[model samples]
Target: MTLETDDRAEAQPTARPSRLARVRAGLPRTGLAALCGALLALSFPSFGIWPLSIVAVTGLALLTYRRTLKQAAWTGIVFGGVFMFWLLIWIDVIGYDAWVLLALAEAAFVMLMAMGQAAVSRLPAWPLWTACLWVTQEWARDRVPLGGLPWGRLAFANTSSPFTPLAALGGAPLVTFAVALSGALLAAAILALRARGRRAGVACAAGAVALGVVGYAVPLPTGGDTAGGPASAEIALIQGNVPHAGMDFLGRPMQVLGNHVAATEALMAKVGEGKLPQPQLVIWPENSSDVDPYVTPEAYQLIDGAAKQAGVPILVGALVDGPDATHVMNEGIVWDPKTGPGAHYTKQHLVPFGEYVPFRSFLSQYISELKRVAVDFSPGDKTGVLQVGPAKIGDVICFEVAYDGIVRDAVTKGGRVIVIQTNNATYEHTDQPDQQFAMSRLRAVEHGRSVVIAATSGISAVIAPNGSVIERTQLATQAELEANVPLRDGLTLADRVGATPEWALALLGLAACGFAVWQRRRQPK
Candidate 1:
């Protein structure tokens, strides 16, 4: 009887250890997922540890491998929540609640993406499918929940990385795919190494290395005098200081306008002294004139005087009175030295709560913040490829730079150079400006056009066609930057292909998920 009791006690101890071992295994995966998310956030601007993004991706792939769909969903929640909350901490400037809600909303999509990725993990060529899944998530997120928030794409993180030139071939979607595939390949290598399959591990490692270095071979043409070739235009970017940061950035109505006018006048003064070369055109930040230049005579005179002083056209961003009393328009007007305001490009994509609150009556009842945007800003029907003096420039205002279709429309519609007119005052002293600036660099390489950014409260910059920053300004400072930028007319492969690659890759990912479901159902339960 004593011998029997000893056997039973030993069996009980073994059972306890089995449960403990399973719990211990799960704890590491959860912790690793959170760590990976933080690493991915660090890959973005401000920290800019880019290689960490690949490492994070590898960690996620390994953690999710062979996971149950439910388990993968939990992993996604942990990873997405941490990464998005970190990346969008700038939204806390509005409210902590707003920041949390936005991060969670974005994370829900990542959860769905993770479920799809798990489904495909059992399929052959899963690394390719996993890469496609990343594009699929981005494509969907770029268009939903009120025109989507595209702040944390993989392509944005790789703006200056070797993966950037792939953007010239297939736009942002391809760059994202390349980054994801490289990381997934690395994960495959790791799995092979753990299994003692040395040959397989070496092959996977080689593929990842090949993918990382392939962008160096892509030819990015920057047609200019520097290349001893075609057209180039000398342009000036003006960044005017704002009164303060936060929601009340445009203090005292005309104060912001005066700041910009003073900066432009100073720029022309330098030209008069021969200290700076004369520019063919001057670009001003969005909200340079908060008052309607067309309706307000003082605003008109202020802009006209600056253009006259510069002896060139000024792309003036203004808040114009709309057709009705309750609405306004965000427009970029071409104010020529002689012609005055001509050929204006109104902002097409309007910010939901920031520009015009959606479901205003319902949402405003709960959130008092909706009351700030009293007048709804109307959207423009046309693209912003306007003739600004000597150059046919694409005018992408503020957050419009984040949209693929908006920027592509301008490039396809005969824009020789791209000008991003933005106001970073509201998001000053945050990583938001740096993040947006990185997008401009990617856009420059994507469309193969010189990108000129003009920002209020700073980070205004001139980026070359090769994704190089020619000139930039300090945040919240009154500064003027001039760069003789290339004006390229030739269309890049990305421009010509448009959204084809994104669509193809996205569809393929969905198909893989469908196949994975079918495969699972066919299995013996």
Candidate 2:
């Protein structure tokens, strides 16, 4: 080849644009994205400025509007990173390095969704499409790459907000869509006002108000209402203090088990003395017995003794000798006062890295913490619904409460009361337990079932079907709360249409993107 031709080829290669050049082009938008993320994170538990969720969405929509795909994607990454980092700061309790890795991985999904938002921003009624796009993104993130982490979801933040009633109509996805749509409309109104378009601004403002009306119009069966069906029986929730917080709780397995048994016995003493009313059933926190109660005679005898003394069915959380030798099962076993151990439900949605390391052979080479879970816990196939005394309880263990399907199954499959058995010993004093408690509250409202959360080191609570906490305990304290929790058999609209609303909304967003692409191509150059 001629020297001139070779020179031209080399120059042409540079003209194609280097990766650094492409990335640098989007750099200016990064600050806005990060700011949007910070606002979003602030909307969740602990900070819980509920309106901030809507504001964050508005910021994201405004930042991505009229931006190129590359710029939008960059904005999404920065936004997602900031939000996930803040939301999962509790993960640092495990290992800072692990927390950063997980946060980055989750941020990539948000980045993908942001690109779609940019694609349809030019369309008429773009805000509506963009809002649905947000729902689609959450739907994808919640179930991808080994069961997606549903933490930091917008719906989880709206537990106390006026928009929460939307959850009763169509579950978490609908609540998410409503919040996002309001934000998008508000953003659109602001943009129109900036352009001096009074008519357009007024229309967008009206649209935002309309969302509030619709949310309130939706018949949300909240508060102490008979809409939850009927009162089943009184239940007691025990929060037994652990020996110490963090992973050390596992090291003192006997103490953790002993603590729960002792707490139960103390409550019974109150009942016998007529200081407290008798509970039909008692619930214990997960990992309350790290020692396999079935295999260890000491653990079994201690549990049996507690059940007999309570004179009621006690749902005990225990680590059982697994479905196999290399794996353990985190299970909720029902101990009958007269018959001993009976019906059991093993946790279905095990935490990805915390419970079992994915790609363990490769990941363990770098992450030393992977070895901490020597034997992985296997997931159960069935939903956690069991009959105990006068109530049919739908039990979800630990992080399983964060998953929609896991929580939904219990309600739809004949569970009158929702019981969440969680061991927060590792996350004591961290916002992690508070964030989890928020999820339980939302679940209580979404399914129209009273939720009872029993935790180790602490934050145990009893929530009404309306998502109101009737009783609760403090962290690192041994406490017992007894309440006449109503058992509601009626399912909310969100329950009857399991996952359909999410799927339909997702399809609508995808269609809008397709149409936007077609419209863009047909435009004259």
Candidate 3:
């Protein structure tokens, strides 16, 4: 052969490997992370497939594996950006700018989680440590600057999954741990399958399958489970449709109040006609009476009339011109048919910007949204265990249900059943209500209490002790959900354990990171 032919032949021999190298190059880290995030977002409410969460976490683990902390953080940011962007899209109803800002803020937490994940990624059974790290990250996220937004938690998404039983064992934190662990286990399975050892691959596959089987066998308490102490109370949940969608509901305050009052009266008429059983307690959604019943005589009379008609104690949600004129109190008032408003539970966890502007002195000048709030809503200093008729209901207003501690406190303080009073009028037909409903389901299992939700713009629901939806109303529809909810006085293991499992899991994650660092230092320079 000639010299020219020989050179061409040499180049041809190297062509296949170069092509193979190009093909073997994986997707960009951020791209993979974003894909993982999108998958995870799909696992939550409104698009709840649940199993997708495991796959998403597995994909994220692979992307993060052996990556530097900086790279892992970037991966987390991309992942969170995609996930939060989709999960919190309902916030766009308020403003696109606000939604984007909130998503970015939440993504920062994910970045922190990814950094910690990178630290322990080198450890043995790294998936287990990584899973614990997830719990820790969530734990931190749930309570940070301005008492973190607990929306989009893993436990909330797994409310209807086979893994929901785990909540009874260790509360939402445990459920979150189980989800992260399963995802990590799945990642391990994938890793093992790709390894050279056939036996390792088989073992991991078997282990993962076995765990899933075990999860199904977990003895979750059902509706048939006895309350043992508190008797079952017939409850009514009112979801009076708003006059108009969006913030317009705020403008027609009296119209909103009239709607709830009318719904309650209609429910009473059903009872009078022997079409429906008389409820021991009638619950109204938050902002059911935007005008303070205590201060506004007409509003008070409207609520009183409804209670009298039902001939039952009515739990009315009211926005009261508070102890100070510059602020208001979002309250759940216990109104007796015989008497007026008595013991009330003021909302403990107020929405940061929606209710009150944080750093108001500075933010008010720059952001027009602050002006919309007008007056701040004050946070109550106590738990929301309310005495209504024969039962004590744990009343959490609107966004308070997202906070684990708030719900748990009421149960601990002798709330036999959980009640969530919310006004989703602004977010009607959005994923917002669906997501909140998911939290109620998880809380039901966590505390082993029947949860009754009263929403102003529908999605009102009665969740069983086992996290099953007994009954739920449609979005933006005028409806009432009535059920003989078992008043569960008994506390599940989750209630008793409180934050221990979360703290322990967090410690394990930190220990793994410490060990990883020590091992790295011990290695040859």
RMSD of 3: 6.1
Off by over 4 Å in 2: 1-28, 222-230
User: What are the lDDT figures for the candidates, one per model?
Assistant: 0.89, 0.86, 0.82
TM-score of every prediction relative to native: 0.94, 0.93, 0.92
Best by TM-score: 1
Off by over 4 Å in 3: 1-27, 223-230
**lDDT, candidate 1, residue 305?**
91
Better of 1 and 2 by lDDT: 1
Given candidate 3, what's the lDDT at residue 246? 82
- Of the candidates numbered 1 and 3, which has the greater TM-score value? 1
RMSD of 1: 5.2
- Any runs in candidate 1 off by more than 4 Å, and if so which? 1-25, 225-230
In model 2, which range of ten residues has the least summed lDDT?
1-10
After TM-score superposition, what is the CA distance of residue 373 in candidate 3 from its true location, in Å? 0.8
Please give the lDDT score at residue 1 for candidate 3.
9
Over the stretch 83-127, how does candidate 1's per-residue lDDT look in tens digits?
Answer: 999999998876677788889999888888888877888888888
In candidate 2, what are the lDDT values of residues 1-525, reduced to their tens digit? 010112234335355678798667555567667888999999998888889999998888888776667767888899999999999988887788889988998898888778888778888999989989988888988998788889888899999778877888889999899998999999889888877899999999899878867776766554433444446678999987888788667665588889889999999999999999999999999988888988899999999999999999999999888788889999999999889999999998888888888999998898887788788889899989898877788999989888899899999998988999999889887889889999898898799878999998879998888888888999999999999887777788999999999999988998998898788678655
